[model samples]
Target: MQYPEHLAHFASLFKKRDIAHFMSAPWLVSSFREPVWRYNFGFKNDQNLDWRVHLCDGSLLTDPQHVKLLNSLQCWLIASTENAAGPGFTNSWAAQSASFRRTLTVIDHILQSAEALELVEHGLSALTYDVMCDIIEQIGTSSYVAVSTYDWNNRLTDYCKSLLQTTSPESIDKCLEEYPTLADITPLQLEENELEIPLELISRVRAALYINKMYHSNPNGGLNVNSIRVSALLYKDTLAGKKRLKPLHSILGFIWRRDRFIREFDGVPVTNGNPDRMTRRDLVLYRTAFTFLQKISALDFKLPSKEDLREIATFKVTGTAMGRFKNVPTPIIFKAIKDGIELHFEHGPQLLKSYLNIAKYSLKHMVNITGIPDETTISLLEPSIAELGVQYLGISTRSSGRDPGTELKESKEIYFSKLRGNAGLLELIGVYYGAIQLLVGATMAKRGSELRDLDPTNCLSEDKSWLIARIAKSSRGQKGRRARNARPIDPLAAEMVQTLIDFQKDLIEIGFIDQHLPLFSSPGIIGTSSLTSCDVYLYYKNIDLFCDYFEVERDSLGRRYYIRQHQLRRFFALVFLHCGYGASAGILQWMFGHTDPAHIWNYITEELPGKELRNTLSQALSERIATGGATHYTDVIDLIESKFGTRNVSVMDAEKLAEYFDFLMETDQMTMEPVFLESDTGLRVDILVVVRKQDEMG
Candidate 1:
């Protein structure tokens, strides 16, 4: 803060620079404009952060004070660059790289964030700029590097571009005249015959040469340099740091590494391989998770640990969905009037009855019509089944569900031949299978392969509490693989499994399938085969088509939220971790099929959004405090609010909100929980803001 000659130095520079251009443009002094610079065209910057720091698009400009300072600086801006892009700052200022604008952007961000208005009241001076640097490094080191490094290579690029512009190609090629200092840099483009020169590329060199020439003649002060405004500029990095994040496009290369080449495609013929589609499906697994995290981290939000990602991957069943049904054709759906069948997930027996009735209808038409069919069996699936399904669901075209620019292109093939499974039967069955799998997977939070291996005879325990799911992953290539009896399951999951058991038992009773087949068996696609057990790959392939027809969820882009089998497992682990479910680490280890305990331990202890959600809750509370609103927990809320002093935490001291939220969580070991309990009306979900541990009896 102590600068002996800082005041004297700034006063000297203020007198030297011409200030006439400050008024050359009238808009700079007029009303304010947002995005005072134009660069990033991304998510709506609802905060309206516009000050033409013009780092990438523009800099952060906030409040009335910045407007006047911007007016004074317009003289320097106009002298060095071009016209303003909207109300923001101009591009190509002082012949700097587009990236260099980010330097000013970061500084403005810090000033506005810290509300250090006094530092900028006279524009950034030498002393104020030094104070800003100390504040910046306190935030993060890598952040400062990302912002300042924009202009780091300017000196080198200037030297190379200038040296190469004057030299002939032969001299450099023969090594007769070489520049060893430029070996690390990329080669420059220089057209000897062209009169055009890139001003931004060589301006630094030209300025230095001009200053050297003037100094040799013993010019005024022997300094001959006047670019002092830049020297006083401190690199604040939050804005510039945001611009340096991992771009969304590089996801293509992130998933497609050389080591990831499909093993099956290596020795086998690549004849039908589309290269794009064929390889993309094979590229999913842990790598997809890595890319997902990388994308999350690039944004300002904290990167999710295992628990947060699990929430994204997990599906929660709503008890109310039982009454809802998307109509598939045929009066069988209306048979509720006669057969006492109702559309509900819990009424799995009624759903099976309807499915069988539809199956019987197909058999009657096929057998009575003669010549085309010889048997009246459920195995002989008719096209009428699909005709019914298609009435309510459109066939999938096998294409993208995400933005073409943001997502990888899909590769899918449709068979032209109308085989037995081709007659819409497979599509309908696949739809049902996908929905079943989605619910079952989320409920069990286990691998699809393991779920498929469930014992139809006794997968559900006597009490219907534990689902005897086989440990396929942990049991691989080991002796006497066994199903875990301790795997606790939801009542809904037990119902779903029992539903599958009843449906397949009828198939086995009529000789449609062998009783020994896995619980996931379905009517075979092959003409001669009666049944085929479902695998992870088969279900994965059928899922997309099923999601197309089913009333599955979609993303913000209106694309289907592609829930994968693996995502389900993560959901189970996360629920147990955050909600403090009965499952222990030992139980999770056996369920997750991990080779080591550390993997399961890490997941169990992974940072929950509870900590992050604390901030969000604080923000919501702060907003309430700022608005002085009424709420249900009046006494408790008043008590909490009274802790803060008169200064508004939301506006006057925004940083204090973190402390207040921390206080709420620390008091009485309060935790946010989603619990359902029996009320006089029915079971109701509890969504309390501040839940006391002892008050939770459910």
Candidate 2:
């Protein structure tokens, strides 16, 4: 019954080709010469795989070695499909045909690019992991492609290991090239960033956010939009020089000149110009005052034409000629501030107060220099200034009240220079949520979507220790898989989660925001509904605003640092990996949920990701091991001693540690455990390593 080597492979290919054409999936077979897996995503017979999976440009498909490996891969593909519907209709990927084929296309790229096609005789061996890594390194830009490829292959590797039973390699995604190098992390500057974000920064940022949220939630949170719009207009026209405000500003220019030179405010001292000079520093106020005079005033006031000052007398309303009436200041200033009050309550004081102070200073300075306006102008201008000041400006003509700035300061609403005050209600809310989102994103290893979709009602368990979130990425191409994973959070993260829950509840209760939205939804955000989805990508901008507001500084190297959700996720992974010393990388992978990590391992869960990252934590671990740094790792060390004879063997020469590491990885499973060891400094140092043998899988 035993066939010779070539005959055995020939018979195996014959069986696989038969299985392809006769069994579960007949579409997979193109021809005996080359059984490339061609897929039809369009209709039942529509073969638009239009994308194809082939080996070695049609040259290697007939090779005995390739034929066998390709046969096994095809069988796995056929087995991967189940009878469910498609995307949106089902959660499991195999439930739909398209998802599996789409994944094969990603794999196809690696297959086509992989060199040394005959390196492995059959199936995806450890050698295939190396080939995959080589292709992964040359990739650019599309990081998602890299993540997806690794994830799908990891699943494939899992399937292979399950079949092999005793030869499982935990995960092939353990390559560190995807991470930044050690030098990239050193000399970490705030302006130019490093690979890792310091926990101290995250902590300090959280505290700053807490204080800011508390600080801003006062005085009804200044949701007022009036000040924001007004200041932006001013800033744009002045500094931006987009220079679009010409016509209106020009009109304002003349009106200002007329007011200053011809009919100067009543009580001020200097002799009024013989109808001449003027200048203006504008913002929304110039437009507002001009509009109040022309559009809102009953006087039908027309600005004086710059061509003639003598025309001031002719430009009057129903009353005496305008030039003769000295009372123009009071009525104009009063009407502009008063009428807009109902439309913009905060608008009058904050917007026009600065202008009012300027007017009085100019008025007083004129009074000191020389000319006085006639009695008629005096009575009108003086009384009007006092009235406007007392009522709208919050200034007391009777007794001293408070400095305007001091009053606003006490209200503690955020104010930016140039009147860009308090309009950040929307951005502030974003910041508040951004802080929570960053904290949650960093602490919880959820995908951006999972983090965005967290349910306020049930995101937490009754005990409040475990942070529960959905798992979708790994569920791709699998059926009936678990959809959610619950992992423990530190005390601070737990507290933050609770606070988030409470905050969402309050927003819903007040009907200020709708209920049933995800915790991060933009409910109170104008134009958004409770059912709308919020992308986590936008959270970084809000976080940056928070940083700018709080003056989050750079590190010692002066490189500017920016934080992204992915970086936070990686940092968390790194922290969990090295934290109590030799904390298990395997457990970190397990917690990440690429495999049924729960099935084969004990859940002393902890965290960390992939590609030959100089910054990849394996180097860190290797360095630690070489130095004999970690303490109390008896079992792994004993295993090390049993094989290599002594811990010193790894440290002996340049290549020995590499061999030692290889030996440890060759075992069924390796993990580090912490044990207290006496250090030279007399401190209690808890450090160690452990290895789980092939027999320990049970």
Candidate 3:
């Protein structure tokens, strides 16, 4: 094959004799040509000479192991040179020989050093005895000697060789029967201070396995902590050459090994020559390393701290069952209340205060929604308000005029009546009051009272101030409710109210309310009455603002207009009529708080249309239902799904589902036939395929 110019350049770089060039431009040595270099450099102690000689020689360092051996030999030569030339050097040949002999001594010293051995030991930390045996079986003794320093120290070399030879698959099985402690051999080697294993190497192996698992499982492949941990161990073991398994085979091999271990020793004693109770120390070590890697990987690498590493390691040790001989302990939750004042300072006091007020309103609305007894809801909210940092004066159980609760109740009723008179006003006040306060407060806080009080009437008028005070007082009373009542309202209901109120208050203090209020309110004047009118005008003027506040967007003007409070009764009446409760008269009677059907009929006959074109659609729907027509229901669904796609079909996809629906509708497929899309039971499948063919003729 013809090589690219870059490859030719790489070849030349590899052939260069300059040591500096070889060291500095190491990337020039293509991985493909590594074998050639390896063969030439095998187990040679030639430090002064360039790598080009080793690459050209071909005989010695053919294998990667041989190349490593030669590199180690060269390192030994460098270390030994200081000890050479003292006694046996009369000639240059004798001097060279002495240097070579000293190099061997240095190599032997390195093999004996605890530090060097510790590095190797750490590398093997994630490997099991059986795995180590497998590695020996795969790599054989020669490569092992090159990668490892066993050749330098006879005693250690002999020990390793014996261990390797005795730990064959069959031998290991027998050993398990005789000595369960054999499972701890890797740890034993470390304990004896024989080798140092690098955690990095183990981590790399684990990472490879994790990536593979992720790739295979993708989407539906469920990943659990245990599986991930196991995968990591397998990866580490494979990479360290402690397991005779390929990278692709590690996961399966690990499972097989686990099964074999379980099957071979079902009830044997763990420590006393029983296979059933094998300690699995190697597995534990690997698991521990895996856990450490997982945590450290999750942390921000840019600011890696020693404390973080120690915490990760500690968690890994405990989390991975490294020390425990039995089941893991459950994590303990520790709780302590932080000072509220301090928390307020950190989070902004005004914001917190606003949250409390919002929480109160939210709770009140929730009570209204659930039709829970007002007294019970109020009792539940009292403590919540106290906790929220509101100082309460007193709660009057009796509805006295002097009591703030009674005052609030009266105020709320008045507010609601005004809402009935002009529903827009209620919405406008709800939308803007808190928001405007927040914006003005923040701006004032940032600037000064001089700047803040500029539009005091507009920004903090007496009416607005009274509104704030009333809301605050009500919130405090509401918070007390939770503490006093043993049996409270539904937990979710309480939480929702709390969350809504807090969110509203936050929006207010941040100036979001003040900024958007002008879009809805009347444009002129600054008197209290004018302000009230503006609030009322805003309430009705920008219905979209209210919808926006609730994150609910009306799709059509009809839908938007239909949302009016007065229209609600009419709509409900129409629904009843279409469902066949008589005409609009009966609907109005049932819907308008009228007790008698006859009165509703008179009103309907005298006024509004008893039925309309829109009502016809509803009547047709009801008729189809009465006739048990599947086609009608199916057609409805087809229309909905065609309009909304997967979004309208299920709640799981949520926004995505909605987006899909929008896409379908916008693409002009509103009348398209229904498609039975393949989907996970809980998942929404967006794409649609036509279930029925369209007519060929126009």
Candidate 4:
């Protein structure tokens, strides 16, 4: 890399040892508590010399061209380092939006366009402190702008301090003058002004702003300037020549006017009438994972080996053998089990020699309960799952199946610990294993209160008959034994359990389980810890990889439709609700481990049961009103009175009313007809018409 005379001297001050020391130390010198005289090679020229040549990549340049490349090489390295190491470099929306165009311009300079160098140089220089803050007033203003931008409309602002508490309903008129984006309505002030703003009003405001229906809505409609500006950083790459270099202006126009693709509320971009939950990068990752999964499924892969099984299964040597007490060493009991299994072997290798068929019964059971592939369900398990009680048999909640003592927030450790496991998960697995053993005519009789207490004999059986296992509880306050009952498994449930077992075994055989190992592991962590909540997200990444691998086709509108995990959970909840399942909301709330049913509401569809019922009743009433039909005489009387408020329609008898109407119709003293009209909601209404018959004739 080349450097100017003064800059070269500056660079020479540091020896190789000094550079090494600097790398190890946070600060420059031992005495210095701050980053004093820290080297920054990307300084803008004080003389304001043309820095166009400085933006170019310098690695390919000859020695003769080094002088010409000095500024460009230094600038490139500095920008690259800053981008890689700077705070908020990857996640900051503002930084990404601001630098993306300049980054592209530099790329263009390196590849084809020389003119872009000037633009890139100018952008980079503008970002420098000297250019951004030339005067003291400019410095102060820039500082204020930075602070204001970061804090303005921050979500963390005090509830009372925000628009809700500070601005009264009476002050709304005055507030509108400043923030005219609010809907034009006279708000009723709350007596408890100190209370947090009503979320309902926020919703209404969001809805109004989303449609750009606010009094002083921006001409650009719902699209925000920041998103458009950020989009420009990408859009500029499409431009091949200088004529098409109006990146900022063109992007803003396309987003706000020409394309009209993005929508925004409160300066934030939204999609599908909701705030976009995922970023573009996340969407890309998911798409890629989905493609990968699809491709693997289509490939018809072979079964996994014993080594492959080890990769997917979250097993540790800490637990005792299947039949032994918790503290017993597993090897001491394994000998008998291995011998028994080996004696029963047929076409396969000896039980101990191969991974195949070994633990097939137990694995089958686990799969039946999980109902999904290992990779898919790995995230649902917590890191502390192993520490749970043996009696629970499966993943338990952080509180070990007990509710927290208080309403106070659970720490991340405790929250993730026992988030609760469905007994059905472990029980179903056990049931499947038991069923398989029963089919083999193995000894299955066990009497116990809980399913876990029943232990099936491993020894082979001579009799091929169904086993009757009884489970009865002892009465707590009475001496008499409780009546024993045989619990029955429904045919459908049994079939699904069997099917899941088969599918899981197939997954194991095909080596898909082998690929699930790293996914199940917590990245950068060692030991037998289960995947944390964050690690579990690797499942989604796996999906993204699958989609990418298969090059999945986009939708009819050329858009990729990726399913998120949360979306799947919501769909499951909604399905339960739509199927008229009893206590679905409560069930979902329990399943989701939500303290309040309202949290589960997010999973519910917008067309709620109450809302739908109301709509249906409203439609029925509307139809009756439109047809001028009355279920009762009072309904007719009420309708008549509504039309003719002064008339005593209620006093007239049904026969008298009929006779009067007939006389009126015959004598033309009154007229009756139907009047049709349309309402804003698009409903067509028909009204019964009665007027002075003589007046109409005249």
TM-score of each: 0.31, 0.36, 0.17, 0.19
Q: Which ten residues in a row have the lowest lDDT in candidate 3?
A: 327-336
Top model number, TM-score: 2
Clashes of each: 16, 25, 49, 37
Q: Put down candidate 2 lDDT per residue, 265-284, tens digits, no spaces.
A: 11221111221111111111
Q: Which ranking of candidates, highest TM-score first?
A: 2, 1, 4, 3
**What is the lDDT ranking, best to worst?**
1, 2, 3, 4
**Each candidate's root-mean-square deviation in Å?**
26.1, 31.4, 29.7, 33.4
Badly placed stretches (over 4 Å) of model 3 are: 1-428, 431-531, 534-539, 553-562, 565-570, 578-590, 594-598, 610-698
- lDDT (C-alpha) at residue 197 in model 1: 33
What is the Cα-based TM-score of model 2? 0.36
Error of 3 at 26 (Å): 99
Assess each prediction's global lDDT (C-alpha) against the native. Answer: 0.36, 0.35, 0.27, 0.27
**Where is model 4 more than 4 Å wrong at Cα?**
1-63, 66-71, 79-112, 116-501, 504-584, 590-698
Whole-model lDDT, model 1 = 0.36
Worst 10 residues of 1 by lDDT: 255-264
Angstrom error of the Cα, residue 465, model 3: value is: 34
Better of 2 and 4 by TM-score: 2
